[model samples]
Target chain A: MAKKVNSLKYEFIKGLWVENPVLISLLGLCPTLAVTVSAVNGLAMGLATTFVLTSSSIIISLIRKFIPHQVRIASYIVIIATFVTVADRFLAAWFPPISKELGPYIPLIVVNCLILGRQEAFSSKNNSGRAILDALGMGSGFILVLVALGGVREILGSGAFFGFTILGDWFNPWMVMILPPGAFLTLGFFVAGVNWLNERRAAQ
Target chain B: MKLILLFISAAIVNNFVLSYFLGICPFVGVSKKVSSAVSMGMAVTFVMVIAAAVTWLIYHLILVPFGVEILEYVSFILVIASLVQLVEMFIRKVSKPLYDTLGIFLPLITTNCAIMGLALFSVLREYNFIESIFFGIGAGAGFTLALVLMAGIREELELADVPKHFQGAAITMIVAGSLALAFMGFAGLISI
Candidate 1:
């Protein structure tokens, strides 16, 4: 029992960093860069994604035995898309402002390679419990990165974090940090940070 | 004139890759080589054009009329997946050389958010049929332009001695960040 728990714990923990979907695997980047202009938006997108990722992963894991190899990809997409639709509508209904800000991105989540990749890789091969753990790990990792990236961009661009003022009148907010370039630049450095950490860990 | 402005806007001012951040997988993954980037661009543009037309019809004529508009996400994705599959098969049958060039990319295009984003954007913006097509072409052109530019720079970057940490995708991303900065200059150049 202890051994089983340990392995499962590793499955979940790996996605938090070592096999991070965003930083390490670099999947589902379009949404990462698009909606992460602000920390709030990043957190919203991350939670929405986590909901879909966890839900779909559990479903796929449950049905893994029944899915044939040839049609598995298609089956996975439909399953994934269904959950995305739910998330999209849920956001639109409950959070009108976030829904509008996120715009087509909610629907775009249907195509997010991160969700689909997890289905193909983790869920399809593992049990529902492991799939759930994996989904949460990856989801948290994704959320962590988004919130950090968004926090950095927001603080620099608007002199605020999560809509609260951080920098004073003396500091000039860099408009470029909130624009498209900032997304890439911030994410680039974040990627570097992850790489550096991994290298340090490896060397030791 | 409106169509032309839309095209230019989509292609330059509001580039899909730079502004909207769509189809980034191919932008980063396949952009290492100029040759492969061009090929991927062509494949994506071809699908985008067709997807624009077909999705417009589906959203307006089919979904709207049937009152099943909530099916938009599921339907659009299904259409794109099958469309790519069908296009791949048709290309393989119709022209060997063309298929040889684009075959590998067709499979990858299914998950490319840009194509789906284009469809959703047109629907959200309430663009008419012709405008949607122009937008598709423009987005594709913009994607191709970004990919080609990134590829060219990366080819050159192959020689530059880079730091140990910020290499590979990390460096590519920073370079893209610079390109995006340049593209931002075109922000108010035109508005349509």
Candidate 2:
């Protein structure tokens, strides 16, 4: 029994990198691709998702024993949706511009598989403390990927980072880097590049 | 005439899948076979239309009247969830073959994001009931178009020799990027 609990830590840590939500699991790709055109947007989205994920995970874990297996998924979604509503309203009321830039993607967080996936896979069976840890790790992993993608796109597309100019007049922005195609191409290469790095590491 | 423009604009000019990035999970997951893609498309279209109508009423009748607009996300998602359940049972009882075709996809539609995005976009744009319906249909058509086109490409891609790393999702993304570039031609069509 003690050994089993120890392995839960491993599961929690795996979500942070070994099976990172954006990079490895490949869940929640829509928001990951849609909102990363700018670093600020990406950071805001990541934090918003983290708030929802962490809160919902704790709630679900606390109530996991009560929810029926058949209706567990539905229950989890309702919990997530409720938290998402809170996050959405908070952002809209306080940070209207980021909310506007994010558009429907904010509400679309309810549909993000990462939050629900963690609840079903981890929180439902784990204690509250473990669930919280797992949620935080997964949330951080997601934020890391979004920040990296956002940084790349912002620098290449606008020669800026987080809306501040880093590259001077010598830099001619690649207009495509900020467009829809840029999102897809950049993510594709990023995935391939990550896989290449992992392969090299494994060989050594 | 207005409806036609709305349909065309949603379906082509601002495609939900390619341009807006809605319904991408199914756009990637269910686009492997043309038949399943069609089924998934139809299921999504059905859900989107209902979601738009229902969410519109909820927003106006409930959220706005009560001044609890903060509950929009919670209410919209709940509405979508129950609606999908209702659609599933209705299909299962009415027609077995239809249910089988759309069975698994129906539950998935509850979280498709395209349906939710349609509802949210309609509200954001302040469209009337008729316009919202049109928007839903148009978005569905656009999703279907992209899914079918992608399925066709992937079918042929099976025969081609591809690099190992770019085999599964990387190639799909690269292809989708090109497709997005192609669709950008329609950007000049509608000013919206």
Candidate 3:
């Protein structure tokens, strides 16, 4: 029915904001907080994650029916790990600087619960097409958050966006924005801000 | 003496959880109780040491020799996953009580970024076999220290009336930020 199609659309759309992986689910906080010291790092990490996520979702969807229920989690992880390997190797060989900047995080993507959580929750149950769409939506949402975090940190920390200076001589960088503590503090406030916005919206 | 300093620096001066921000998931999730946190920490330490040893051999002996160092991420992840499963089964068969305590945490360890991060860092730093093992133990101990301290704070925090928006994860993060700042004092202790 038309209603079914509409609901499928809703499922894909919701991941963008309503249930954003970073803000709402709080999944994959490791990379989100770690690699966002620069906008370029965030973009690279986000795109790499998207590649793994989209590819794994498609593959999982194609074989969802054949995978045994108990072993599904293991299967999804293996698939994800394989794709991550490819991404990591590609980055190291082609983009060594970004790879080094990201450090071990590129490999850490394998265990990112966001990808596995999606496979278990949505991809396993849904058809291949819907799963791909949902994966894309969620991946895009994650990328947006990474870019925003990276932009804020990069601009404030070094007066740059993606290695290009956005702030002029008048601006003095907040040195903490590039440090480990800044990651926690910034994300903490960002999450609280998201919650506050939700509350106001609901009240309205 | 140098090795001991490496261990101490990694474990305390540059803690994986508090300073480096690796493995925040379990740092927050499993740190609700002191006992559970201790168990999780020990389990992580055990796997990390083994993983460090195994991955070092794989990287230096196998991957590098084959000129396929590019496969490091893939192989490391797969190795960690299988290692977790192997350790879980071995523990269950050998020690029931220890298995019971570490039962749920074993599977969770597979996803703990600290394990994978330790492996990658070991290779990146080109640490030798013994150094890698020490790094693993140090990172594990660091993770445990952070988790237990956070749990202790949370226990006391249960009494405090946190602001509405800062409750739960938000407040936990802010507290962790302060802890990270405190840990920063140790940074100057070791030049490495």
Every model's DockQ:
0.88, 0.76, 0.67
lDDT of 2: 0.89
Question: Model 2, residue A14: displacement in angstroms?
Answer: 1.6
Per-candidate TM-scores read 0.97, 0.96, 0.94
Candidate 2 segments whose C-alpha is farther than 4 A from its true place? A1-12
Residue ranges of candidate 3 with Cα displaced over 4 Å:
A1-6
Q: Name the candidate, 1 or 2, with the larger DockQ value.
A: 1
In model 3, residue pairs whose N, Cα or C atoms come closer than 3 Å (at least 3 residues apart or on different chains), thus clashing, are none
Q: State how far residue A127 of model 3 sits from its true place (Å).
A: 1.3
Residue B141 in model 2: lDDT: 93
For model 2, how does the per-residue alpha-carbon lDDT over B1-192 read when each residue is reduced to its tens digit?
999999999999999988888888898889889999999999999888888899999999989999998788778888899999999999999999999999889988877889889988998899998899999999999999999999999999999998877878888888898899899889979866
Candidate 1: C-alpha RMSD after superposition = 2.0
Better of 2 and 3 by DockQ: 2
- Tell me candidate 1's interface RMSD: 0.7
Taking the tens digit of each residue's C-alpha lDDT, what string does model 1 give over B1-192? 999999999999999999999999999999999999999999999999999999999999999999999899889999999999999999999999999988788899999999999999999899999999999999999999999999999999999998989999899899999999999999998987
